[model samples]
Target chain A: MADAALRRTPLHDLHAGLGARMGGFAGYDLPLSYPAGVMAEHLHTRAAAGLFDVSHMGQVILRGERAAEALEALVPVDVLGLAEGRQRYALFTNEAGGIEDDLMVANRGDHLLLVVNAARKEADLELLRAGLPESVTVEPLDRALLALQGPGSEAALAALAPGVAGMRFMDVATVTLEGTEAWVSRSGYTGEDGFEISISEKAAVRVAEALLAQEGVAPAGLGARDSLRLEAGLCLHGHDIDAATTPAEAGLGWAIQKVRRTGGDRAGGFPGANRILRELAEGSERRRVGIRPEGRAPMREGVELYDSADALAPVGRITSGGFGPSVGAPVAMGLVPAALSEPGTRLHAELRGRRLPVTVAALPFIPSNFKR
Target chain B: MKYTEEHEWLRPEGDLVVVGITSHASTQLGDVVYVELPEVGTVVTQGDEIVVIESVKAASDITAPLDGEIVEINEAIADEPGKVNEDPTGDGWFFKIRPTDMSQLDAFMDEDAYEAMTG
Candidate 1:
């Protein structure tokens, strides 16, 4: 379908004016890249900074007394203990111990802020409404989210809102940006030191233009964002973690805080907690591990993985695969048996009619540069 | 010189025909990272997929313009596939084929017709 027939963000005009090649993501018509192209945009975000329009992602406010306590019933994370003005990674799990969706929840002073994936917004909204008590209110915010990411991002953002620099990673603050009120969070998906600014649609272009005027802040697209997150070992919602894969299977047990574990005071209250706790203690049978291609051949998703070179018995399948520009190598991720997930273990990815050499490398083929 | 409907470009070089993806196709694929070049001495039929080009976003197939025997393959693309994006028509040529029937070239579009089709 044409980009025009799809939903567009407030920054569409700016992206079009910058000569970006457009594509469909979720239900929005987003920029795939500007004139700089994907490789340059990826490298640029790693070295400098890249501006991304992530407004399509869902943002909601959970208000009322006992908001955190109400939320803890649906997720395994220690939501009740989350400090004000701080963020935490969470997943909405099903009763069967599978992940419904992965999301970010922040403890605002008066209310809790939740950022869920774009594709699961409607379902997640209904899930929350169906589960939460009458005292709790779920309010979806119509705010535009813009992410300025890289080593140079803080400096560029601090120029507009000086107090933002004072907040550490996962910190949130509502401050004035270009004479307009905007909520700023010191977090991003790229694993880089960056900030996600939530502002009104009317002020999105103005704030983006002001940030772009700074040195080395190029506008990026969803293509670069996907490659960036993959290199960082972060899971994409439907691709890496789905309704069929549990947090333990996806290697996301760390998101379950210690206070919410078996021995803690409030243990095993969230949905699928019993199974998740069991898996946490014993480990899941299948594990998600990184695959480093030995050759230049880029083995893509759905390719069957084999135990040995020239072997026919299929062992696993690739979930996400591509050339990681920052790593300067082809990187992929797939589920394999527990015994085959160790780093440096040799494996094979069947392509065409032959089995190509692949090694089980550690997750995050590239190191994360999040500001500590 | 001619262009196939699938955007494969062919240029007659003496008795051999050199093939590459059109500049339009390369730009659409974004950054080309890996390419599977056709093996030399392989016999391919007209319009068969013989080469695989992978970009960061997707993978695309480059089909043969005519029935031919692959003579020479470009090994440079294996080490650095960005050449496909840097120069789609020049250094990024996929392979050279010795055509089994020269009349197959007449089925492709000329420069003007291909330009109109792409635009």
Candidate 2:
């Protein structure tokens, strides 16, 4: 086991002062929840507002004349077409067409801001350092990122930064807060209207404290964040999508630009282009689909999926599954044969030696509330 | 009545000792959402994994405090595991056990010792 004293987030003291249950997460000692518990924190995010310290996520800035071209060599997304102040979700792929990591890339004023998962940050940075051209400088921004999510997020943030209310979803803006210039993005992992604020490490605690003072804003931890993202039908790295899974099979084909798919002007140039283009045209052998358990019992990750008619043989594997706090039921996403990926297909999840009936459902178990 | 270092309490009732999770253990676990109970007539030894308790944060194993056979289990926990969180020492009693070795009970910690260990 790793030492608990590995690293501490900027809000570590604040969370401890609030009597939060602290735990080790991605090498950082983070809050799992406050005294209100996970259920209350989860419901608070769905109904009102919830403040989350996501500073553990990796933040990198790429700068140079050919920054977009350098980034395009590693990712499948069309970075050249990304307008300033716009953000897009992209995947870092290997030469074998397998996903190395999933990230959110935003075009800042002169540089590109990339936010990768916390666990994969180090590897992602190494991959970029080795792959990108020397002209592109990849610098890690050791700042703190906070998320204010749910229906009341806009109103709460608008109370502090008034101009934030006008920013559409996936829009990024540079705003100054109390003399500190912070990057605020109208984006979040939770399937709700929210904003992700990136502030300097020194000002992180102050911003979190300011947001926590709002009417509906309650401090949420990783526990509620997992449930909330599960309800949102987001794929968690390592659990849902891994190095063995390709972007096409993970159902992230939309992130791949159509111009790049066909032999257009900027086509067949990125890493794993041959395999990715083939999968784009012919489709993948397996696809990620949403699974809704028939009853309350959750079919967690790593559970084997079997045909409902003959529960003995395995046909797929559950990558992520859990109880959706808002949906009030057990929902999951699994990689099954494309034949079984269709919505309404009947399957069974083997949990604790018993087979539980599950139905293939649409992604985003709960309707997304993005402010598009 | 006696307890174990593992936070399980045993109450002697005729030839059986009723087993339940301690209040301190339940409080630390927060809301009890599910309980995996041991089946009746199953033989278990001291320190063996018996019951499984799950909260929102994570799942925990409740070990057997004495060598015994499960005479009866509280089926109510299957329907409402939160009872354990509300009153762990009362209605949340896990199961009644018929001791296979009475000396195991004598080796267990007493109420004062259990409280001191937890405190």
Candidate 3:
């Protein structure tokens, strides 16, 4: 999309002032990297704290007495059971057992706050509006989201909102920062211990500046966020999990709480429950697996995977692949037959007309360090 | 030293020509992680992609600047691709080539012209 047509986040001027290399993403002109470059930004996030402008993501508020129960109709997650101030990962599944979009559902006492993917936010809003009862109001907020991630993120954020230091992973609370009310969540896309702060568009720039000014905190961009999530084995919404992928096939059955499973208290009321439940009971034919390319060359998305060096047809294809700056090697994720999904299973990726050896490794090349 | 539209710099060293990307190109391709260089003695024609570079952002190719045989390759870059970003025009040279027609270098841009084009 043209830069003129692309949307700008509240922190767009702040990013430009920081010398960010802006690029178009999900209809927004956002920073792909700063002057420090993607590699340095990624490494800095892993070692210290990196602030990210994720305001491109959609934020919506679901209000009503039965908000949680109403939401359970769309996602397989047990939203009704989610406690106040806690958040759970959820997905919007279609009737065909395919994923519509993955989102985070946070219970904010009287209502539920839904954070959806940027590309699917509009459609997700329509889905929620049409699917839920009219009594439940769906409000899309014009807010800017910032992710403060890494080992030192707590210290950096605690400096501004001292209450943030006491929260654990997946906890959400309201905190005052820079004289404005900020919705803070002790969660993030990166596997580091961090927080995702939701601020009003008016206060976004000041809040971002305050966070960036903190010691051990640097401004990272979309490029570093992607690499960090890949190393953490977190799936990118469109790339790793998409409209054609089922939760079971994507290895996301864990997100579907047992309460929504076949024999649980809630049973299956969500869309695509039949197929999703079947896949959960009887294993999926294809499973998402981690792939480690043999050499330095990165096996990017769409690279076909084969069973052997001389295989005629591809057994699978890489969904997401890139260099893991933290791991110091190339890592990837792909979907293959269940028989070939085990760690240590050998696979070959066709890169530039050559089939190179790759190994089926465990997910999350780097273990997550979330504060429990 | 001479430069190509693709941002490569070619400096004649005796009969062989040293080829590497300019700092402008390296800065554009931030933090190169891997480089795939052709083996020594490999023959290539002009515009043939002879080197594959993988940066943190994306993958790109360095095409052969002139019809020639690669006399020597830079293994240091293959092992440590960050050199391409650290010193793109000097120690980061990709290969030494014995050009079939050394006059082909005449068509490239000099420092001032290349700077003007990039600028």
Candidate 4:
């Protein structure tokens, strides 16, 4: 997208002042990298704290009687069982068992807060308004979300928000950050101990500046964010998991609680429950798996995967692929036949008309460091 | 020294030409991770895609600037691709080619012209 037509985050000036290289992503003219470059920024995040401007993501609040029960009707997760001050990863499913969008739902005692992908925010709002009862209020907040992630993230954030250091993984709370009341969640896309702080647009710059001023905290951009998430094996909404990908096929069945499964108290109520439950019980035809290319050449997305070097047709294709700065090598994720999804299974990815050897490895090239 | 529109810098060394991308190109590529160079002694034509460079952000190609035979290959860059980003015009040279027609070098831009075009 053109820069003039794209939306600017509240931290656009801050990023520009920090010498970040700007690019368009999800209708926003955001920072792709800083002067430190993507490789360095990624490594910095893995080693220390990296602050990110994720205001482009959508934030919404749902409030009403039986709000959790109403939300359970849209997603397969057991929302009603979610405890206050805790967060759960959820996905909106279509009638055909495909994922509409993956989101984070936090139970904030009286109301539930949702953080959805930027590109799907509008569609998700429409889904909420149409599927939800008139009594339930779906309020979209014009807020700025900043993510502070890495090993040093706790120390950095604790300096600003005193009680945040005590928060466990996936825990959410309304805290005063740098004297600004913000919703703070001890969770992030990177597999690191971090916090996602939702603050007003006016306070965004001040909070971001405060975090960056802390020791070991540096400014990161979308490029580093993508690399970090890929190493953590987290799926990008549009790339790894999309409308055609079911929760089972994407290996996200762990997010579905037993209460929402078959033979439970509230089972098969969400959209495409029949197909999703069946897939959960039996299995899906194609499964997403981690792939490691044999050589230095990186096999990127859209690369066709074949069962054999001489195969006339491809059995699967890579969805997300890149050079993992933390892993010090190239890592990828792709869909293949269920039978061939096991780790150590050999597959061939076509690159420049030549079939390159790749192995189906376990997900998350690096072990996760979540506080949990 | 001459430069191609594709950001490749050609420097005459003996009867052969040493080819590498300009600093501007390397800065744009941002942290190259892998480089696939052509085989030494392979005959190439002008505009033929010969070198494949993979950076952290994306993959790109360095096409042949003139009809020539690959005389020598820089194997160091193939092993350590980051050198291209460190010193794109010096130690990061991709290959040395013996041109069939030396007159083709005149078609490329000079230092001032290349700087103007890139500017």
Candidate 5:
């Protein structure tokens, strides 16, 4: 285990004062939960509003002449079409159609803003530096990012940035928050209407405190964050999609633009375009499927999925599994044979020495509340 | 009743010993979300890992206090693991055991000694 003193977020003191159970995550000593506990925090986020300090996520700026062109070579997303003050989800892919990481690319007026997973930040930076054209510049914004999510998030953010409620999903704007200039986005990992505020390390404490002071907003930790994202049907890096998986297989085909398809203008341009295009045309051999366990026993990650036949042939392996707070049941996503990926397809998950019955289900077990 | 340094408490119940977690251990572990107990007929040696307990934060192993055969397990903990957090040393008793050797009890610490060690 890394030493607890190694890294600290801006909310460290505030979380400690609130009696939070501290844990090491993404190189920061962050709260695992407050005194209200994980279940309460999870339910709180689903019901009203919850504040999360995701400052550990890597924020970067790609600027200069070839920034957009250079970034286009790395991911399949159409970055050139993204208007200023708009954000889109993109994936970092290897030459073998494997996902390096998933990120949010925001078109800041002067530079392209990229927000990536905390654990994969260092490697992602290295990949960008090596592949990005020399004319483009990459700079890391080592600061605090806070996510205010749930139904009441719109009103909470509107209180700080007037007219922010008019911004649609995936829209970014630079707004003055508590007299400090910060970037706010109508986007979040939780399948709820929310905003992600990017503030300076020094200003994060004030912003978080100001938000938490509002009605129906409480501090949530990584534990609740995971459950919320899972219930939202979002794929977590390293768990749901890794180097071994492709975007198509992970059910993220919607993210790939129609212009990048086989007969389109930008055909065969991005890395892994050949394999990715093939998978886009002809489905992958294995695909990620949501599994609903028959009983309350949670089928965890790495558990094998077996066919119900007498031989009990192994067909897939679970990637992410946990209790879905909104659904009030145990749900999981697994990489199963493409034939068995259809919803309602019955399968079994091997737990301990017994095989538990499971059925494939539509993801986001609870319907997403995104502001369409 | 006596407790082990591992924080398991064992109480004499006729020829059997009823074992459970200590209050100190429960409080340290936070909310108990799940519990996996050994089968009734499973044979366990002293210091053997006999149960798996999980909180939302992490999972931990609960060891057997002495060499014994599990005679009965508290199935209630399977459904409501929080019972362990509510009364770890009393109503949260995990299982009863038929000791393989009565001399194993000598290795355990008494209530006063256990309390002093914890302090």
Candidate 6:
């Protein structure tokens, strides 16, 4: 999409002021880099702190008495038993075992809050609207989301909102920032200790400015955010898990809690539960695994993976691949045959017609530093 | 002598002309971490991709400026890819190509023309 056609977030002007290298992504003309660039931004985030404007992400509220039970009918997770102020990673599956979208469901006391992918917001909402019962009311929050991610994040946030320090990883609290009400979650996608602050569009600029003015906080664009997540072994929705991929095959079987799986209290009520449960018992044929190419030439997405140098034995394809700055090498994740998905298994990723040696390593090229 | 729309620069250096991405191109690319150069003695035509540069974000191809046979590639860049961003037109030059037809250099835009076009 052209820049003019793309939607602008509340903090678009702030990014423009900071001279962000904007690109068209997820139907938005968001920043791809800053003046400091991606490498510096990525390293800074891991070492110190990085604040990202994730306002383009969708914030939704599922209301009513049957909210949790109604949500369970659409997703494969056990939302019905979710404790207040806690969040769980969940996915909405189709009837054929493919994922519509992977999301974050938080039981925010009064309502079940969902954070869906920015690109798939409308479709996800449509599914939620059409799939749920009449008692449930779907509300879209016009909010700006900012992520304060890194080792120094807690300190920076504590300086402003002291209550944020007490929250554990995956904990959600509606805290006040200088008296401005905001929903602060002790969670982030960067695999670092940080918080995702959800504030109204009216208060977005104030909160962002405050965070940026703090020490050890630099503005990171989507480029650094991507490399951070990739190194953390986190999957980008459309690229890694999509309508063609099931949670079991995508290595996201963990997202489905035991309460919704076989032999649990609320078992087998959601879409594709049969196929997913069966895959959970008997593993899927193709598994999403991490790929580590052993050279300077970074293997990119759509690169074919072969078992031999002769290109005879085809295994899989790269979904997302990039140079992991922190890891100091190229790291990629792709869907490959379950037989060859074991760690330390030597595989060949066909790059430029040459079979480049790639090793099947564990997901997350770097260890996650989340505040558990 | 001239620049391509793809942001590659071509300048005659004795019998062999040097080819590299322009400084503007490097700035836009940001923090080049790796470079893939073709082997010496390879034959390439103008507009044919000759080098691949991977940054922290994405990979981009550097096209040949003129129909030429590859004489040399910058080995220093292969070891220290950041040189491409530091001195794009000098030490960061991607390759030295012996152009088959010297007249092709006239087709590209000169420095003043290229700057105005990009600006």
TM-score of chain B of each: 0.97, 0.95, 0.98, 0.98, 0.96, 0.97
Per-residue alpha-carbon lDDT of candidate 4 for residues A1-372, written as tens digits (9 for 90 to 100): 236899998999999899998998889999999988999989999899899999999999999999899999999998998999999999999999999999999999999999999999999999999999988999999999999999999999888878988899999999998788999999999888899999999999999999999999999999899999998999999999999999999999999999999998999899999999999999999999999999999888899999999999999999999999888889999989999999999999999989999999998899999898
Best by DockQ: 4
- Per-candidate interface DockQ score: 0.81, 0.42, 0.89, 0.94, 0.37, 0.84
Colliding pairs, model 2: none
Docking category for candidate 5?
Answer: acceptable
lDDT of 5: 0.87
Scoring model 3 with DockQ, what do you get? 0.89
Residue B81 miss distance in model 1 (angstroms): 1.0
Work out candidate 3's RMSD over C-alphas: 0.9
Q: Which pairs clash in model 4?
A: none
Pairs in steric clash, model 1: none
The TM-scores, one per candidate, come to 0.98, 0.92, 0.99, 0.99, 0.92, 0.97
lDDT of 3 by residue, A1-372 (tens): 238989999998898899889999999999999999999999999999999999999999999889899899999999988999999999999998899999999999988999999999999999999999989999999999999999999999999999999999999999999999999999999899999999999999999999998999999999999999999888998899998999999999999988999889998998899999999999999999999999999888999999999999999999998899999999999999999999999999999988899999998899999999
Q: Which regions of candidate 6 fall more than 4 Å away from where they truly are?
A: none
Of the candidates numbered 1 and 4, which has the greater DockQ value? 4
lDDT of 2 by residue, A200-310 (tens): 999988888888998899999888899889888888989888888888888888989986787767886777888888998899999999999886666678889998746
Better of 3 and 6 by lDDT: 3
lDDT of 6 by residue, A1-372 (tens): 236889998998899999998998888889899999999999999999999999899999999997999999989888987899999999999999999998899999989999999999999999999999889999998899999999999999999999989999999999889678989889998989999999988888889999999999999999999999999999898898899999888999898889888988888888898999999989999999999999977777899999878868678988998888999888999999999999988889888778889999998889899878
Candidates' C-alpha lDDT: 0.90, 0.87, 0.94, 0.94, 0.87, 0.91
Q: Using TM-score as the measure, what is the rank order of every candidate, best first? A: 3, 4, 1, 6, 2, 5
Instruction: Identify the CAPRI category of the predicted complex in candidate 6.
Output: high
Which segments of model 1 are wrong by more than 4 Å?
A1-5, A310-312
Ranking of models by DockQ: 4, 3, 6, 1, 2, 5
Q: Model 6 chain A — which ten-residue stretch has the worst lDDT?
A: A1-10
Q: Cα lDDT for residue A281, model 6? A: 84
